[model samples]
Target: MSTHDTRNTRGRGATHMENGSITQHENHTRMREMTQRNQDMERMKEEVIRHVQSRLNEVLERALTDSLQSLSTHTQTHTDKTESTNNRHKLEEGKVFIARCSLLDELFEISHIRTIYHMFIAALFLFIMSTLAVDYIDQGRLVLDFDLFYYAFGQLGTVVWAWTLMLSYTLLGPYHVLRVWGEQALRSRWRTCVCALTLCAAQTSMLGIFPVCVVLHYQLPPASRFIIILEQIRLVMKSYSFIRETVPAVLKNTTQKDKSQRYPSLSSYLYFLFCPTLIYREVYPRNPSIRWKYVGMNFLRILASLFYLYFILVRLCIPVFRNNSHQLFSSRSLILMLFHAAFPGMLILMLGFYAFLHCWLNAFAEMLRFADRMFYKDWWNSTSFANYYRTWNIVVHDWLYYYGYRDFLLLSGYKLRSMATLCVFAVSAFVHEYAFTMGFGFFYPVMFCTFAGIGVVFNFAMNDSRKSPVWNIIMWVCLFIGQGIHVCLYCLEWYAQIHCPRTGTSFWELVTPRSWTCNYQ
Candidate 1:
């Protein structure tokens, strides 16, 4: 039992020992793998954290750069604006200082420049005086003979004389005179001058051919039509009635110079309506530069005469005879034509005449007479466009400024200064129409009112300086064309209303076919 049992037990014991050793080795291998995996996971987590911190740093740097760049750009823009504003201020100050310096040095600086200036001024004075004196002599009917041909020839001679004097004074007279007298600023000033020249040139050319064209185109009549004479008389009577009614209304509103002052004449009323009140009140601060400007204006007087002569011959006398007519040199026909062109033309002509006379007298007084009273009380004393508007024909401007401009603004309850300007201009057009009705005995107020109303609206609506140049030119052209159309329409209406019996025969009806035309007699 001992030998057999011992042998079997030893074998079983060996087997059991081997099985236990194998199990122990397998367990050790599993523990090693699990520990290694955990260590690798911890290393991976650390690497991921480091990578995230690096990315955040990069983003932070980018954000800082963008914020700094934006701030710098803003700072630069502000600095530039400040610098530009400073420069503008400096320029304005410099101009004012220089002007003051010039005035201070005037007495000491009176050298050859001064002498030449004075001499040229004297020559201009003489030229203007001579032209005006000649005009007066002609107008006063001093010449004994009054034949039509002679009258025409004399007028032509007067025009030639005026032209000659103007050219001679401008070319041969002092050099300073040209500089002082002829220099003009503002785009509108030049445009107006060009338009005036165009008018004269065109009209003169047309007029020169009129007599020949008339004679060739139609047979002469023994007697002029009496119907036109009666029409004109009726028109005048109607116009007189309108004016009589209007004048009293105007008088009631106008403040008098004194309680004793009588009611104004038609001419005076015209002056009031057209002229600016601001001219009577000082607009600009007084300075030597301003004073010298008047002297220069005096020199320009001769040139103004040339303009006047051009208007009288080309605008008035010539246009009337452009087409062929049955009546040859008939006084009644001439009068009729004159009446047709009278209102607007007279308003324009009177303003020019007043300016011309003032300048002429101012020049003469400054050069030959050296009268202070003339400078103070004379017409050219208000030669500035603003002054001329206000003082010389103050009633017109006053009416515009007060009733037209101020009243409109107040009535409309507009607080903006810009709108106020529009209100005034619109009012001006209205009053101008009213005046026109008094002269024409028709409701031309609508046409003229619209024309002027547009101008007022435009002057206000398009107030930006950048847009002004083109707009101003357009306005001027429109005004010229509108007025021309108005004149033509009036003429056509007068003809149709008198001759045509049809309900749609009135000019307004012909154009728009209104019910009013059907009811008119």
Candidate 2:
């Protein structure tokens, strides 16, 4: 073999050896990279699994805790209710009394709520300024004369006299009758019936008939009539409650042969008559001391409210409706009037509620040192009319629920809850209409139709099932429209009666709405 051929073969062999080593090193490097990737992937997977397990554990723990809390709350509530039921007498099973502050009183403690009150006061100042500006523009002078107030509150002496008589009758008549009846050793069914009849007759004459007759005969102004009629209703309810509460104990005592049971003290009866509560109790939750400052503040608020109402009427209400009766009645005008009246109507409604429910009642409650200041509840928060009715005026509602609704249920053997509710609504509507009719000296049934008809329907429609804020808005809208309708129609009717003279003096003519036929324009 040639020497050159041997050298070339050796070089080729070296080259092949180098290439194989290089290939082996590359393969080892690739294997390490793949192993590192696998380890990283495994670590990531472990982290994901741990995260999932931790989240699941937290969710389970939360669910379990919530379930335990709910169970504990339900058990505690049930225990309290059971204990209360077992301890309370059957007659007093329904009514429960607890000392609590009014919703506004609590809300007013919060700064934000108090700011809203300040806003209302500011708005009232604006109203006063507006009234002054208008008076200057129209009459070249700022008229501050409260002529409407004077007219509405006329015949103060008659109101005072009538109120005194009614109160005296309520204080003396019902208590004496109950005392005399309870003193009987043997309360025979006949005697009981006679006593009941006597009470019914006396209440009808003194509380019911007397106030109506006086208002009609004396030609009392609207405010005076309201005072007398409201007092009349209050005394009536007070008397009924006294008799109802005491008679049950009397019968029970007589049956058990327990002579220790005597009539409730006259002092308690008088206190009940003046207290803010309509439901009568032998003993009530009372405050340790009266806060004169608080009482004074409430009265000041009431006076402010009165001025607020006056401005609302003068600026927003009277200007629109005073001359509206002279215009031809059309649906478009009526609708425009309704919408226009809505703002003022809402203002009036709120003012009425604040003045009467919050201010007046709170003042009286403080003066009496009545511990339970829950004359009303969070009615503004109510999304349903039923809830509103229940919370709006708790004093009257409690009386109606216990005396009127519960009694009807008892009489019907609890088989007619729906019927009982209807009856209660009817009674409330009637009383409202009756009061307005007497106060206004007209037979307008606007309140009656709205209250009994639309009110009942809304009570069922906007039930507790409505929980959304949309429902709340809808409830407020309904209130606005209702108030607008009431204010517009009543105001129109009032002016109509003045502008349109009656052609016939017949009973139907007297009761008929003058706004329907009056075209003074």
Give me the candidate number with maximum lDDT: 2
| Pairs with steric clashes in candidate 2 | none
- Tens-place lDDT per residue, model 1, 1-521, is 69999999999999999999999999999899989988988867766776698799989998988886777687988867776676445422311111122221232244555675466456446545555666578686333222322433333333344334433332222222212222321124665456445534533333223322332233222111111222222222222232333334334534342345333334433222222111211121223323556567656655654444444434344445333132343456545654555544443444354454355444443343222222112223321222333444432343345434454544655345566665555555654564444333344455555546555554444444323346545544444455444544454344333444345446764444121232222
Q: What C-alpha lDDT do the candidate models reach, one value each?
A: 0.42, 0.87
Superposed model 2: Cα runs more than 4 Å off = 1-92, 185-190
Please estimate how well model 2 matches the true structure, expressed as its whole-model Cα lDDT. 0.87
Q: After superposing candidate 1, which stretches have Cα over 4 Å from the reference?
A: 1-399, 402-422, 467-472, 490-521
- lDDT, candidate 2, 436-475, per-residue tens: 9999998999999998999999998988888888888999
Query: For residue 461, what is the lDDT in candidate 1?
Result: 49
Evaluated against the true structure, the overall lDDT of model 1 is: 0.42
